[model samples]
Target: MPVRRADAPEPERRDLDVRGTSVRMLSGGAGPDLVFLHGAGGAGRWLEFQARLAERFHVRCPSHPGHGGSPAAEWIEHISDLAFHYLDLLDTLRLERVHLVGASFGGWIAAEVAVMASHRLASLTLIDPVGIKVDGWIYPFLFGMDIPEIVQTVFHNPMAALALAPPDQSVDTLAFQYRQGAAIARVSWNPYLYDPLLRRRLARITTPTLLCWGAHDRLAPVEPCAQAWVKEVPGARLRVFADSGHVPHVEEPAAVAAAIAEFCGGIR
Candidate 1:
């Protein structure tokens, strides 16, 4: 298969049964465990950026329930529910301490996880997170936008976004994308993406945090959002990607990965 040709994308695929619920994961690399919570789009797939992270740490990226391979549950409806779900995942893995990285929607989840319980967490990194409501932040209505619009909103370079597009987006693929969108809406629609209480709860987080933002991000103004993250989370540091959009990991993987390595390397 092309996935195994040349620079092989060799990730171990595993489905972990966490008490009756099944969690699908792509795991690779061999250092300290690094749990990655992905954005809405790239679920159940390993990308080049993941492989780069795996070069230094054992990277575990899970498909959020109902998004990709993971099954949806009746009890899961909001971001708080997702946060507890990941807590259970950590307990199931018996990982006492692991670094956590969340991108976009996943960054929101990571933040909740840190506040809910940071006993087992070593460090936290949030990449363009959007769970906190800041006035005049200007987040585009993610669900209202079409695929092209979504892509345009997320990438600084149009060609880079176009290059990643799948040639044949079959019906099943499109259906899956909508399902993910529905899942996102279920959690984000009520208060319009940002949790009303999350900003206040930020002070509860004790984990060392790195807030990463893209300078050219169209979804929201980078300065206010990043500044808010830094001010709210105690001792949190901010890093800005000068020429990327919402998804820096997709638009500028090497630079993002390098920043991550430097931040995570100091631990232990």
Candidate 2:
């Protein structure tokens, strides 16, 4: 399991209905609003990294509908559905603007939100995100791999990957994993794993964006697919973590946090 610092307290969890979708949110600290979005298949559990981030920012880590404790929304048709729902969430919370930080599928949603409502965003940080469809780029099917295989193939550090999996894979846990995978597929299946037209829409995003990628990412390699985001988004900057993979925040939290802190400093 990922080791928690001795100084870190357990996070507080709660639920709220955002636009008819029940959202489970893990909250901590108090400062500027920082919204953390996890990848597909993961839950707010990964928000442990956000606790450290909360030291300087009020962190709100919401379980995307259909993942973890959050109930699946019937109306969730596409990635854009998630983007709009989060907008509703901000409105419900009465936050004028927030620093958006997302990973994997959450990163894709952040990009969509920046394009659709950049004015409501203070800044954006994406870590090994996937959403745009690029020819010849094959996104590893995370749902298809067993936990061990996933850990070996998707994560650069085996220890981090092992920490991410449940201690014991009971029948109940396996069943829940399948159910979560199915729900994720429902919203992200048609074009295999990405929106076919999302790449063309990147230019409209006006938020100061930071794209961070793990150099060893096999799921979404940095060279072509992941690095493409830096070129597409106007004024977007890229940072590559040489020793990390898809989930850099978990693999190298300190480095990820430092990069984010620097990027967010300009906003405030």
Candidate 3:
């Protein structure tokens, strides 16, 4: 037996076909549209943070291709492809000037989207975003480690991660998780996660930006990397979540949700 999700909205999951790829998206609540792009581990299921956001804005969380229920778009071999695909996704969904929120890997995609097309965005919020490469900073062995090792490295509070996890772990669930990892490896392996040209292009993104980071992030060092985002991206503000890990939303759901709500409220 396996459980699905905890704190996720009771809404049924739906899929939309965009350019031959099934983009699995979950929509809930009302008000202005707010799109959530997940990180490398994949947006498993809507978390308490998403539910909280849905209270104030219409939240749309879509699983990246080859992750969750979203089928793989084999042609997508790079982060640039994902950026382009999201552009198409916006057109297909008929969404206009929506607020964008991305976490981890998704934050990189959000930055790419803003760089490629800022006209379609009203605001941008990144949580522990990873796109810029800093000299002398190296990420831990991602694909080389087991789940426990990665978990310990990813979250500051291991107890929170364990509590948030699905109580019933099934074979299918493990397989799905593995698939998401493989998909991440495919796109991120060559460049090793960060786009060589991204830092230079941050200046082109004109949308209001907010950078949120877990103080205990081990993957992307906080010093030069997160610091670099604030320095390079004009008008971008940084907020650090104390005692949180890479996924602050999971570790500190209420605080992260409140930060997002407040940020979105001031967007003009």
Candidate 4:
């Protein structure tokens, strides 16, 4: 529901065959290759954040398997499977020295991917990622909450979320949401969103990393989660948005996009 500017270029939708599994991708702009991995909710939607990035980078947003228009992959069992899948995706696309960005659950996947192959990425950006756990910090059970409550929990300001609200929750919309939730459950339900081994593996990531966080995040509180990531990932820097919550890109798209551009620009 983001207001599209007249000058914003329309993204091209294409289907990719990543190891025989068809993946849907929205790609546009004409600069360095930058791939964005969406959160549990934002898959397949080109938001204002991505549009802004498209102005500066050739943004490639692909829907994770089992989400969006992509069919579920039987081979995907754990979150690690997704990490390997994306590695294959990069090879399939013949992309090298890519700028990789991910948010929320997708952030977790990005971290796993970077751990396995940081050399493939030029820079890694994680926005409010939830791969590692800090003692005494607990993530809220998102599946237990209704859509409205989930919306409120994610956005610091109600009006910020309202500005991009969908017109209505039609049957198809609700079904799509349900399917996406189920896809999340498949990989994340066992340990309740955090991978026990991922924390130990983060040190393996040698890529230049940027950690973006919403200061007011209630889902994955910033004080511990953001700090934990910055501490574990070597040389990973933190950028906190004061007026946002869990989903800073959705709540403060322009600011988040600008920060990403600045960070990626400095990656050399």
Candidate 5:
């Protein structure tokens, strides 16, 4: 488990038995149910961005199988597996008309869930997602990149990424990151991050979709990736953070949270 400082707003941590898997989850706040899905790197951490969103809505952040403290599910061979896991999670919680938010890879998962069952969600927010392939637009190949290169590519402000880094890159930290990488590789390595059929399935998402992207995102550029998503999902809108990169929520938490809150507010 990643350690949180004493000063941060703390959320209740518990394990839920869903789909024969014990899922580690963090839940807090007092309003509508809002589930946040983390990207590849950060998982099971109570970050400031989540705290901000929790102020107005009940926020539930779950560690996907094989990430953070959650044990790996050997059956999860594809991204769709993770998507089904989350749908089961929502079913287990008995959450209705919930707001779903996902960043980067998690965004892909959220999109998948919406495609399968839009009735469970009130709104969907995707941040710098990389699941759909756009013709004539190519992002960087992330499999072989070093940490420094990845950090540079993910954040517009280098200092912002550095500030989020753990104080010491100890063996435990390295192992934690390695586990996350391996989990990503298991599902994404062969396909190289995009699903061939996902683009065609976007029309199935009846839930209102919000696409949030960093104007400076090097991993998934705004031109075709973000714009392409808007065109695919019916009535989808785009919100771009001029000063951020791939992960706008991390770089601009307050603004990102505000945008999400506003979007969810309208749906209610």
Candidate 6:
């Protein structure tokens, strides 16, 4: 069901019907499953950093419903809907446990998954994530900004940011992206940045968790919003990328990949 993008270079892709929604996933290498979830407006292709980790772990990156080539689900309303869908994906794939890594909104989903199904996760990693609203800290609304403005705020290198913008997108594609962004904001906008109740639930997660933050992030600033995770999530470790912003994997792939490999490798 998952069709490979004609422009994509030889990446193995497949689709699984989870709760009646077709979920597109890209997979490579072999061994323990390591799933990567991208943030808003991102797709499975965003998991290029996981390619190196694939040599030791079968990396599974799924295009969240309504983003990339996946069809939007009418029943899905909240972020938890996406989280539960991922849990269903694991069940459909017969994956008993896996190492999960997510960015931004995907990170929020990963947190929800860990809280809901601890037995299914071997470990968890969140990068510049947004799921909890910290008092006194104001987080920016990324969806409200234009594409170029959003990129400028999230990436340190202007060239790298330029490379991420969809070059061949048609008017219809751009319109659809905006619509999807609006839908995501509608469900996730409450508390302005994150759900107020999410932080309270972090203490219950038993899996070894790592929180990676971009020191220069403007979208989800580090000092308070990002660092707070370490205090709330028991035994959670934090790694800050000095020269990076919101999307560290894109801004500094090697460092992001190395941190992930080191953390996941140490997990029992």
- Model 2 Cα lDDT, one tens digit per residue, 1-268: 3566668767788889887788898888877899988886558673346757877788888888877635668788888888999999999889999999989888988888888999999999999888998667878777677778788767888888755675467886766666677777987776766887789899998999999899998888887876688789999989998889888888888778878988898767
Instruction: Show model 5 residue runs off by greater than 4 Å.
Output: 1-8, 163-167
Better of 3 and 6 by TM-score: 3
Which scores higher on TM-score, 4 or 5? 4
lDDT of each: 0.82, 0.82, 0.82, 0.86, 0.86, 0.79
Which 10 consecutive residues of model 1 have the lowest summed lDDT? 1-10
Tens digits of per-residue lDDT for model 4 on 146-254?
7689888888876667654544689876676667678889888868888899998999999999999999999888777888888899999999999889989887888
lDDT at residue 98 of model 6 (Cα atoms): 95
Question: Which one is best on lDDT?
Answer: 4
For model 3, how many clashes? Answer: 0
Candidate 3 structure quality by residue, lDDT tens digits, 206-240: 99998989999988867867898999888998999
> CA RMSD for every model?
2.5, 1.7, 2.8, 1.6, 2.6, 3.8
- Give me the runs in candidate 3 sitting further than 4 Å from their true place: 1-9, 163-171
Worst 10 residues of 6 by lDDT: 1-10
Error of 1 at 36 (Å): 0.3
Off by over 4 Å in 4: 162-168
Q: State residue 16's C-alpha deviation in candidate 2, in Å.
A: 0.3
Best by the TM-score measure: 4
